[model samples]
Target: MDVPALNQTSASLTLFCLPYAGGSAAVYRDWQTRLPGWVRLKALHIPGRGVRYEMPPMHGWPELLDLLVEDVQSSVSQPFAIFGHSMGALVGIELAHAIRSRYGHAPIWFGASACKAPGSRERKLDWLSCPEEEFFDQMRVLNGMPEELLQNREFMELVLPILRADFHLCGSYELRDREPLECPMLVLGGSQDLEIARSSESLSAWARETRAPLERRELDAGHFFINTHRDTVISLVADSLARAFHSRGSGVLPSRSYA
Candidate 1:
């Protein structure tokens, strides 16, 4: 259909991206032009934000994962990789597992940015109930959202529900699959992020999730490092895609153990 966030092309592989909480499909729409022409871009637009703003927000993973899996199953008929940032990282991991379980194949590569390994993170969703002022401050420090917008009452009012639902989506999540994914994985964190991924050690914990090769990287920015460090993220994705795709293949799914 008329999906603006998805760029369907005659590329060798598709990279499906999930955004951090409060982020939508628009987050990766700009990456299409920067990425090598061989990889297609399909940033799944979650309902109730950005392009699908009219749909009600999803409050938890069961529904969200259903949507994610269904969307990917429909669009990704060929080999593909998955990447997610922050809250998106958590969702992406689950999405990968769900896709693998139901479809019997895993992504060729998976990348998770600015998120701690699942089940190892400190419980921080308490901020979900904090006062608006406190929530604003926390989100400001965590995601680097514009201070003016965070401080603006009207703006916050309009976006707060969506943000809260997004937070719930990540906060209420419990990783179901304990076995490491068979697909190669890349885990990334921000060196300066004091909130979620505070240190390289935290990011490194992701190694336990994948039986295949896993790489970890820390950038020199804050939580939303991807925004400022787009080139590096894009480059990394391209490199991984190349390494995994091996130059001339289509319609292949990486062999992986599921469930």
Candidate 2:
């Protein structure tokens, strides 16, 4: 696995970003203005997307996590935070676990957006093996895939495989017994996210994955609210990083109780 550096080196804490299914590192290219001077943004480019198009994407958790964990170990030398959206949110959890297990340390902050909390028994549709026409229809309904890509035969021919591989990875995921992290977590949801509202009890459920305090926010947009409410999302992230910095020195986190 090749880890692409999204921004130049900085002494600030690195905020590693993992993108949603069918997303590339480029999704976060415009975040520089939103991030604070003390935070450096790094976006991970998974295989089968962007510059890694030639490499086949892995569908299983064990193999994909191993490669990603190794990448994180080798690439991250500074204190870091992990942020992920949709499928990437699940990646963030396992990545944080692997980091803690190997280095005896975890991220300063971890944020997951637009994803169902792990262990929710909500059955996701099998977009991977579904008929091509039906799968395309599902993509249309989800509003994740762009119309331009779907309309272009050559582009769809290229991206559909990657999308299917990512969807398969998400659909095949199963929860395992893993120790929770002590790092603070932020859970973001869009107000109109029917999938999240229908699948999980609430964002509070993310609390189960971490021992430290978890902050929850629901934006006024849909599942892709990160784009619609980018500034607010960035502000929340900045606040989390600030709290983590202060807490690191004081050895205390802000008090909060989750349901």
Clashes within 3 Å, all models in order: 0, 0
- Residue range with the least summed lDDT across 10 consecutive positions in model 2: 250-259
Compared with the true structure, the alpha-carbon lDDT of candidate 2 equals 0.77
The best candidate in terms of lDDT: 2
Tens-digit lDDT track of model 2 for 1-259: 2222222232347788999988888888878666755566888879987777788977777888887877678655567889998888988888888888878878878999998888763545576678888878767766776777778898888788888888888887777898888888889998787667775565678899988998888898778877778778877877776677557663333221110
**TM-score, one value per model:** 0.86, 0.86
Per-residue lDDT of candidate 1, residues 59-152 (tens digit): 8677888877888897555778899999888888888888877887778888999888886765546545767887777786796687888778
Query: In angstroms, how far off is 46's CA in candidate 1?
Result: 1.3
Cα lDDT for residue 258, model 1? 11
